[model samples]
Target: MIVVGAGPVGLTAALLLARRGHDVQVLERRTLPSELPRAVHLDAEAQRVLVDAGVDFAALSSPGAGLRLLDADHRVLAEFPREPGAAGMFHQPDLEEQLRAALARAGGQLTTGVGVVAVRPVRGGAQVVTDRSGDPVLAADLVLGCDGAGSTVARAVRPRYRELARPDRWYVVDLLAPAPLPVWPGVHQVCDPVRAATFMPVVGLRYRAEFRVTDQPLDLPAELARFGAQDCTVVREAEYEYGARVARRWRTGRVLLCGDAAHLTPPFIGQGLGLGLRDAHQLAWRVDAVLAGAHDALLDGFGRERAAHARALVRLAAFTGWLMTAGGVRAARVRSGLARLLPSTLLAAGTPPLRPGPWVRRPRVGRGHGVGRLVPDVRVRGRRLDDLLGPGWALLVCSTEVPDLPELPGGARARVLHRGALPDLGPALRDRWVLVRPDRVVAAVGPRAQR
Candidate 1:
């Protein structure tokens, strides 16, 4: 299999596929990994997906925290705790390094300094032509377009899909703060009539600021001054404002698209990267299953499931953008009234609040299947489920009479836990038998008698 793009989403998809024992090749145009911070947040769901892909979040830099919304004066309009299990402010470069390392450990092949010029479907496979030196043609049974918004693969599949146009434009500037500011660790948004600014603390004292420019031509110096900053050194800057858009179809024959190549959205909700990660996880499993002789119909579910999730995210992002960028007299009144009426906790309650910790354990049962799902990571009988599972199958025996059901065949491993031993298990595991997948999703839940 050939995957295009080496960003986090692309590398992640490659790693998952490689772990499933596929011969995966990752192609990228960049000669090296990026050093600048692009994305500022990773929600709980995305972090779980990374952990399941073999990433060690605990070992990375401490997560950035909380969300603070403010008006043009920098007065707090509302503050919300970042969702539980979400990553606050780690550098994008650092996160990408971790992902790249995981991909390496998983034995995936990564080709840098290579650009895919075009992709087309062939009999039982796809052919990709790249500008990398040496061989210009790469062949694989399947092609995955993980390339960003301007995706060549998506262009190739244009006849089968349509691209939606976004409505606005935004710019992001990453900086290395000479010193720490009084700003909170979480996200801070400063809203105004003509423009807005967003502050994100990456790691330590460094930070990233995103500015929404109303007019086409932007004055960087003036914008920086408006945000109450001066003499700040810029690390990177890029334009982002665009309305949400997605392909009509994700797959056309052996070639498919994932991540930004398949969809694009404003960063208002911070769901852009998270959605991309989900795309990787969803497609990886189905691709592996298909390669393993699973029915092709299983592949059909990828677009359906992802499209459902993406649509919701798109709407959420659009709503957030509209609220933050509201203008005119009525908008001003609405914004001011909301600022006065809501307390910080009430504003934040809509999203999961942040917790204090370097590593927050998620709840799980049995093994493999429960890892990715949201469960309190607690111990039963002095053993944490995460410690016991180690990326494998888990079996929870709630009944005294452990069913005479057959053990997992082949190399699969299983764990047995008594429901009576832990009171907490009563709620999450009511059934006598529960089977968890490697990623900690519940595969099967049932009574021992039924089994």
Candidate 2:
């Protein structure tokens, strides 16, 4: 297997593939991880994936509290408190460095300074074409494109890049805190129509502020002063145009697209990187299943499920962008009122329920709606639910006896975790169990478990 563009997503895919006993090679253009700070957030789902991949977040970042909406004057309009989980605010370099190390430890080969021009499907598998002339074309059983927006591999597939929102520009600046500055300990969306912006305390000594700005250059000092960040020293600043977009297709033949190669989203809600990590997780496991002698239809199911998820998230980001920067002061006041009315679940960061496909069970089955969604990372006997399942498909029964294995994948009658240690698999439900996929997604609800 070959993974291109060894960013976090690519590294994660390679790591997972190698852990599945496959020969994996990761190719990257840069010899080392970039120090420039870009994405600075991740949710529990991403953290769960990283933990499965053997990346430690304790030394990289820490989770924080609160997601607040503020006026231009920095007055709190509405607030939603957040809880600490496996995820946290982290710098890009720290994450990539750890992922790279984990990939290496997983026995995946990483070849840096190599550029792939394109990938094509051959007779039995895929071939990777490189920029270097006279080099042999590399053949692989499978190829994954983790390349970014201008993905050459994705271009090879000739899929339409559907633009979901009008292109917009933003000036993002990362500042160094001279000391442990007494700043607000959470993310703040400055929902001012005239000057919409976001401010957050990044991990380490870093602070970042992004303003929805014109395409032209701006006086950095003045902008910092306006944002009341003049005291901090600038570490990095750049102008980037961002918007909501997703690929019309994710897979073509043996070459598949993941991460930014499949979708693009504005930074409004900080889901950009988390989406990619989730894509990598989904892609890795399904490919593993196919290679393990399962039917090839599992691969298509992976693409379908992921593309739907990516589209839903991009739409959410677009809607969130509207909520943060649309309308006048009167409209802002209305938003504040509406925010207060909003449920915490709506504001929390999590994946939407998947449609019925492959392992995803139909919804409205009794009272259990967990199918097609990630199983909660509940601790059973001091071990995470993920730790109990390990890296393969399993039957997670909350009952005394494990059920029959009709829903289990081919020859993969793996572990069974029962309620003896679970303590709580929903006290209200009777005769409940869940078939968990390798990605920890609830694949099916047990018989008679649904209402």
Candidate 3:
């Protein structure tokens, strides 16, 4: 197996694949890991992926308080409080280091300073051609493009692409502050049409600020004059394009696209990193299944599922962006009023669950309800459910008696819990069993599994 790019997504894909006994090789153009962190923070769902990969999130990330939507005057419009398992601000460099360590532990090979010039489909699998001075060529059973938005592999695959938002420049400013931070460690989305920006406290006293591009390059000192020039020192100033896009197809034969190569969501939701992590997690098991002699069609669902998920998140980010900065004065008033009137739960994460796809089993009793929703971490007898489930399907048998359970295509274990043990199981499990996927998403709910 060959994976392109060594970002979090690529390294993670290599780690998961190698863990399954696959000989995975990762190719990267860069000579070394990045010194600066790009991604600001990760939520509980994304944090779960790292934990499953053997990372200790509690030690790596600071405790986060979730996100807050503020008005022009900094008055709170809405806030989404982080749940107990939610992650705080995580330094990207630290995460990359952890990913690299995990890959090494899994025995995955990572070659830096070597770039893949092209990936061409051969008779059975694909051939990866690199741009090293020697111009080495390697054969692989499968190829994954974990590269960024301008992925060479994605272009080679020639999948139809759609742009959700026009690329707009945004200025980012990182700062190092002395002890006694000026602001609390929380994300503040400033919703001001004059100058929309995102403020986050990175790591300790380190802070990051992002603002939509302005006519004149923002003078960091002047823009942040309120902070008092002596309080913080500027680390770096950079500009990046912020937009949303997704590929129509994720896989073309043995060549596949994941991470930024597959979709790009606005930073409004901070799901950019999480989505990539999700792509890796979703594809790893299926790739294992296909290699295990499952039907080739089993790999057909990757594109559809990821596209749906990316589209939903893109829409949510765009909607939130509008509520934050799009509207004019009159619209802003209405938005503020609506924000105040709306229930706080609506602002919480995991609002609308991803629609079930080929990989998901539609619920028989709830009419597809809870089918694709991610299951919150629940502990039983002082052990986390995921820790107990390990990396396999979980059969939460709740029906009075096990009605001939269906064989899991990828193997599963039967775990029966007494009634009321997990109240979050809802009424569905009271009379039926629930099939949870390895990624901890509810797969199906019925008296008996269908297949």
Inter-residue clash pairs, candidate 3 = none
For TM-score, the strongest prediction is 2
Indicate the worst ten consecutive residues by lDDT in candidate 2: 422-431
lDDT by residue (1-451, candidate 1, tens digit) is 9999988899888888888788999999999898867766676567767777888765654564666778767777766675544454467778889988888888999989899999988977899999966889988998989998889888776724333334676788887767776667677777676567787777776777887767656677876665544567888888865758766788877788888888877777777787898788767766765776655565666676566567656766776666776676567557856755444432232233122111112334442322223344457568655556555556667666655544442335566766556545435455446655454545455533343
Task: Give the Å shift of residue 246 in candidate 1.
Answer: 2.6
- Judging by lDDT, tell me the better candidate of 1 and 2: 2
How many pairs collide in each candidate, listed in order?
24, 3, 0
| Candidate 3 lDDT for residue 439 | 74
Q: Candidate 3 regions off by >4 Å?
A: 227-230, 333-335, 341-347, 365-368, 399-401, 404-407, 410-424, 448-451
Top lDDT: which candidate number? 2
lDDT of 1: 0.69
Q: lDDT score, residue 403, model 3?
A: 47
What's the CA error at residue 212 for candidate 2, in Å?
0.7
